[model samples]
Each structure stands twice: as C-alpha cells, then as structure tokens.
Target: MSDLKRLLKSSGIYFLGTALNKLLAFFMLPFYTKYLSPSDYGEYDLSLVYVNFFIGIFFIDIYVAIMKFLLDDSYKSIKNYKEKIIFAGFVVFVICLVFYVFGFYIFLTIFDVKFAILLIFLGVITYIHTIYGYICRAYNFSYVFVFSGLFSALIGAILTLIFLIYFKFGYVSLIYSSIISTIFAILIIDFNVKIFSKFRLGFGDFSFVKPMFFYSLPLVSLAFSYWFAEFYGKFCISKSISLAQNGYYAIALKFSALLLLFVQCFKMAWQEVNFSKILDKNMMSDYYTKAINEYIKFLFLGSSFLIIAIKIIFPYLIDIKYYEAFIYIPFCILIYVFIGIYEFLTNIINKINYNKYLPKICIIYLVINVFFITFFIDKIGIWAVIFGFILEYIVACLMIMFLIKKEFIIKIKFINILYFLLFLTTSYICYNLNFKFIFLNLVFLLVFVAFNYRNIFKKVNLFNR
Candidate 1:
C-alpha cells in the first residue's frame, strides 16, 4: 500500500476509536449541562486538567519510550524488547503508585473528598489504559486498538447516562464512567495481546530502563511544562472569577473538542508514519512538507465548519445559563488550529532526532502563557487565557520551524491562508450575530467546501480506492 493509503486507513480507524473515546464527553454536553451546575462542571474540568498532568508526570510518557524502542519497520524489533518494555512500564506504574501514596494529602487539600478520590482512581486507570493501548498499537493491532476504544466508549456513555439520570451522581458520573470504560479497554487489549501472560513478576531485563529513561526524561519535563501552559487557564479562571465562570470556560473547551477529534486521529496515524519513514531521509523532506500543509488546510477547514455549526446549533443543546460560553469557542478553535501545527512539528522534531530541545521550547511556552494570562486576566477576563494559548502556540510553532529548518523546510501553501481567512470570517460573523445569521453562516461553509472539495478530500479518497 502507498504511504498515503496507509495514512488514510490508519487515520480512519483512529478517528472511529477516538471519536468515541474523546468525543463522548463532547456528545454528552447536553445531558451534563442539564443535570449538573456550572460549578460542578468547573470542579470536574479543573480536576481533569490535574489528572492529565498527573499522567504525563507520573507515567513519564513511557508510551513514547515504547514507540522509540519497539516500533520499527518490522515486527522483529518489537518482539525483541516487547517484554522488557512492558516490564519498564510496570516499573513506572509502581513508582507512580508510590507517588500517589506520598501525595495523597496534597490532592486532598486541592480538591474535595469526592473529587480527590476520583482523581486518584481515574489517574491510575488512565495510566494503565494508555500504556497498554499504546503497546497494542505498537504491535500493529490497529483493529483491536480501534475496536477496544469503541467498545469502551460505548460502555462509558451508557454508564454515564445511567449514573446521571438514575443514580444522580452529577459530574462525578463522568469520573465513574471513565474509570469503568478504561478498565474495559485494558482488558480488551490484554486479551488480544496477552500482555501480562508474557511477563514474570520480577523485573525482566533491567538494562532497558536506563536508555528508555534517558530518552524519556526530557519528554517528561516537556510534558509537564506543556501541560501547565495548556491548562493554566483553568486556574486563572477559577482565581479571577467564580468556579461557575470556570465552568463556562470548560464548556468552550468541550466545543473545541471537535477540532481535537481530528487532531488526535492525525497524531496517532502520523506517529506511525513518522517512526516508520524517518530513517528514509530521501522521503522525509517532501513527505513532511506536504503532510503539514495538508494538515493546516484540514484543521482550518474543520474549524470553519465547526464554528458555523456551533453558531447554528449550540444554543439549543446547552443550558440557558451556559449560553455565554459560546463566545469563547472561536478562540478555543483557533488555539487548536495552531496546536495541530505544533503537534506536527513535534513529529518532525522526533523524526530528526532532536528530543533534547523539546523541554526548552515548552518551558518558553509556559513562561509566555503565564505572563499573558497573569497580566491580562484582570482586564479581559477569560479572553486572557484564550489569548495566552494562541500566543503560546504561535511562538512555539515559529521556534520549532526555525530549529528544524535544515532538516525540514517548512512551507505554507497559499490555500491554507485562504482557509484561515474563511475560518476568521465565520468566527467574526457568528460571534456578532449570535445565532441570528444561520443562513449566512451555512452559505460561508458551503462555498468554502465547494471551492476546495477536491484538495480537501484527495487523500481521504485514497481509502476507498
């Protein structure tokens, strides 16, 4: 199969899988807004940000090590170190458990009793599912990987609704559902790969740990800084305004998940392409340049359509009190646009074997993000946070581009600028009209699609042929 075909195929499966796993929270917006208060959502969202950081920090992005060591052009490389990689992952999990025990009091002080416990459980299960799921994908069990996510999401959605509608668990319903679903995902991946069956209790080959940690430690720092920059907004919102106001910010984030649905799929599929093809220098420059240009075009086009769709449909689905959250969606979408680009550059960085600089870039991002939000939140409210992220991604993308200029000549196609213009126009019109100009918004979306359908769907069509 062609590289384009493989990319399309993998992206489709990943889309189906992640659409369920990540976008389930998105699809449940109506039920949540109806059942829970804004403050409740605020609590969950803040806790969620912390849990994500916890995974990145405590898990140490071990999946990245797995990718570096186990993923290659052939299965032989994976088979050689598979058990040891699994053992390394287990060792990391044990270390994280120790941290949890030591840090339990800190979490309790930060969150309420219910949320603190949920945070711990969710963190553990998410770490388990993440590593195991990555191992499954590393083994080329793409079908199993995709299906496991779908099944787990189905269970999560069902359990979430039951907990909310019947048991009245409120925002904690989301917590409970995620925990159960992740367990199912772990079980499914283990069933297919028999991960634990291949392992004995003692550390199998402690030799792998040194190089793995050497490769991953910088990434751990990068992850922490990246996460802090990414989520510092929630903290700003909570401090500057009420937690209920932070809930509105969280709602905007959920709407932005539309872009994330695509971003996550692209990241997973592109990682496969990157690791497989990075050693082939002849294919690196042209393939990466084309991939990025196409990526920008897709992200902007999707952002355009989503902004218009939200303008037309969002008011009805959400609670009246939370309607104001719509104002922030455009900024959130635009942030994801650059986020998509930044992630693409990250792949290039990894492909070029420049992992050391990642920490410096992310730390700079954190500093800029903090400065903007801290300086402006008092004046512009949540827009400070929004603007902080936009600036961060812009600067981060520029820095990465400069660093990788020799290896990858970054180019921006003219069509991508056009996409950005359309996205901007849609956002402006929709924000001003406030659901009043539905026909005009739809027209903008349709005309843009009509002009670029071929360019947009060219690679997508490869899957069918």
Candidate 2:
C-alpha cells in the first residue's frame, strides 16, 4: 500500500474514533454546564491544566522515543522492545507518582482546594494511560488505540452524567469521570499486551537509554515550555480575573480544541508513516512536499469552517452564558493551525537530529508568554492572552520553518494565503453583524465552502485513493 493510502486509512479510523469521543463529550457538556456552576467547572478545568503540565514532565517525551524506536528497523525483536518500553515507562510513572504526592500538598496550598487531590489521582491515571497508549501506537495498532479511546470517552461521559447530574457530585464528578476513563483505557491496553510483547524490560541493551535520554531531554523542556505558554491564560484568568472568568475561558478553549481533534489524529498517523517512509530515498522530497501542501490546505479550510461555525452553530448548542466565548474561537483555531505546522516541521528536525534547538525555541516562547501575559492581560482582559498565544505560536512556527527550510522548502501558495485572509475578514464581519439566527452563518459557511471547493475536493480525492 502507498504511504498516502496508509495515512488516509489510519487517519480515517482515528478521526472516526476522535469524532465519536468528542460527540459523546459534547452531549455531556450541556449536562455539565447545567449541573455544575462556572466556578465548579473552572476548578475542574484547572485540575486538568495541572495534570497536563505534570504529565509533560513525568513522561519526558518517552512517547516520541517509543515511536522513533518502533519505526526504526534496528529493533529486531518487537516482544523484547515492548517489555523494555513498559519497564522504562513504569519506572518513570513511579517517579512521577512520588513527586505527585508531595506536589499535590504544595499545590493545594497554592491553588484551589478542589483540584489538589483530584489532580494527583488524575495524573497517575493519565501517566499509565499515556504509556500504554504509546505502546499501542508504536505497534501500529491504531484501531486498538482508537477503539480504546472511544470506549474510555463513552465510559467517562456516562459516569460523569451519573455523578454530576444524578448524584450531585459537583466538581468531583469531572475528576471521577477522568479516572474511570483512564481505568478503562488501561484495561484495554493490558488485554492487548501480546501485540507489544516484542519489547521487554531488562532485555534491550541499557545503552539505548543514553541516546534516548539525550534525545528526549530537550523534548521534555520543550513540552514544559509549550505547556507553560498554554496554561498561562488559565493561570492569569484564575489569579487576575475570577474563577468565573476562567470558567468562561475554559469553555471557549474546550470548543476551540475540537478543531485540534482532527489535526492530532492526523499527526498520530502521519508521524509514524512519515518516519517509516523517509528512509525511502526515492520519493522522500515529493512526499514531504505533497504532505506539507495538503496539510496547509486542510488546516486553512478547517479553521475557516470552525470560525464560521462558532458564530452560527455553536450558540444554539451551548449555554447562553458561553456565547461570549465565541470571540476567542478564531484565535484559538489559529493556535492549533500553528501547532499543526510546528508538528510537521519538527519531523524534519527529528530526521536531521537537530532536536536540541527545539527546547531553545520553546524557551523563547515561554519567556515571551510570561512577559506578555503579565504586562498585557490586566489592561486588555482575555484577548491579551489570546494575542499572546498567537505571538508565541507565530514565533515558534517561523523559527521551525527557518530551521527546516533547506530540507523541506515550504512553498506558501498565494491562493491559500488569500483564502485565509478572506475567511478571517468574513468571520470577523459575521461575528460582529449580530445575525439573530444561523442564517448569516449558513450563508458565510456556503460562501467559504464554495470558495475552497476545488482544494477540498483535491484533498479528499488524494486521501480517497
């Protein structure tokens, strides 16, 4: 099978899984908003923020290492590699647990009381699920991963509805739901150990650890810096504004994150395929070129559609109080677009072993984010954070592009740029026009879709074949 065919098949399955998961979560949103107060949800969201940050540190980018190792032909015995990977992952998970226990106490003193204990539990669960999920990905068990994810999400949604709506669990419901989901995923992973049994602990040469550590250390720092920038908005809102405001921002972020579901699913499949194929010198350049072009095209279209939908479709689905969050949707979608580009560029960096610079770039963004958030957020409110994120991503994207230009020259199509600008302008007008219903939104959606029909068709056909 062609690389493109494999990517499309995997991506399609991944998307199906992601879409089902998101749809389940989306249905539960109304229940959460109706039952849980903004403050309650805000605390719940903040716990996740901390969970993500700690996960980044504890995992130390070993997930990337697993992907790279699996794709490399050097590891002849899959069973041995799987065992080693699990052992390494367990060691890291234990270390993270110890840190988390002490960290939770300190965090409680500093942050909201509701999150301190909950986050620690969620963190451990997240760690196990993450490690197991990586094992699944390494073995090219995309369907297993996808199905596990959907099942977890479904279980979470059901549990959350019961706890929050029926049992009156309040903020605790979110944490419990997450724990249930992670447990479900881990169970599924354990059952599928045969697929990943090639990797065994104490079997692979310990020498691999040195190179893996060297490669992953920078990624750890990069993860920290990236999360630092991302979580700053929530942190600032929590400290400067009210928890209610933070809740509002979180809601906006959640909706905006839907746009990323597709991008992430694509990345998961694409990265593995790209790495495996890069060894084939025959069509490497063409593969890179085509992938980049398709990525840019799809991202632009996706962003455009999201911007339009935020204005028209989302209001009816979400609570009236959340309507204000629509303002941040465009900027948030842009952030994900930047992220997609960054992910693509990093493939080149990884290929060339220039991973050291990744952390440096992230550190630059981290510094910029702190300064910008501290200086501007009080004056301009939430938009300041949005603007700050845009600034950080723009810098990251440009830096990655400059560093990787020689290997993969990013040819920016003018038509793509024009459409992006047009879509942004149209979205802004549509947002401000105050169309009473979905009429104006429907009109703009059609126009945007019509304008990009040819490009859309090309991508669809490219993947369909």
Could you give the C-alpha RMSD of every candidate to the true structure, in order shown? 2.7, 3.1
Off by over 4 Å in 1: 20-24, 73-79, 110-114, 200-203, 278-283, 434-444, 450-465
State the C-alpha lDDT per candidate: 0.80, 0.74
| Poorly placed runs, candidate 2 (over 4 Å) | 77-79, 92-97, 110-112, 195-205, 279-286, 406-408, 434-465
Task: Estimate, for each residue in 1-465, the C-alpha lDDT of model 2 and write its tens digit.
Answer: 677667778888889999999888888877777777777778778767777876665557766776676677767665466456555544544655687667656866775566576677787778767767877887778788988999999889888888887898787887888898889888897687553444444444554566666666677876687676767778888889877888888888888888888788888888778667645544555667667877887787777666666666676667777666777777777878877877777876777677888878888877887888889988988888888887887788788777766555655556678657855765677667666433655576677677756564565553445
Q: Compared to the true structure, candidate 1 yields what TM-score?
A: 0.91
Q: Residue 250 lDDT in model 2?
A: 82
Question: Model 2: what TM-score?
Answer: 0.89
Quick one: how many clashes does candidate 1 have? 0
**Candidate 1 lDDT score relative to the true structure:** 0.80
Q: lDDT of candidate 2 vs native?
A: 0.74
Question: Candidate 1, residues 22-86: lDDT per residue as tens digits?
Answer: 66666777898999999998988888888776666655777777776677544355444667766
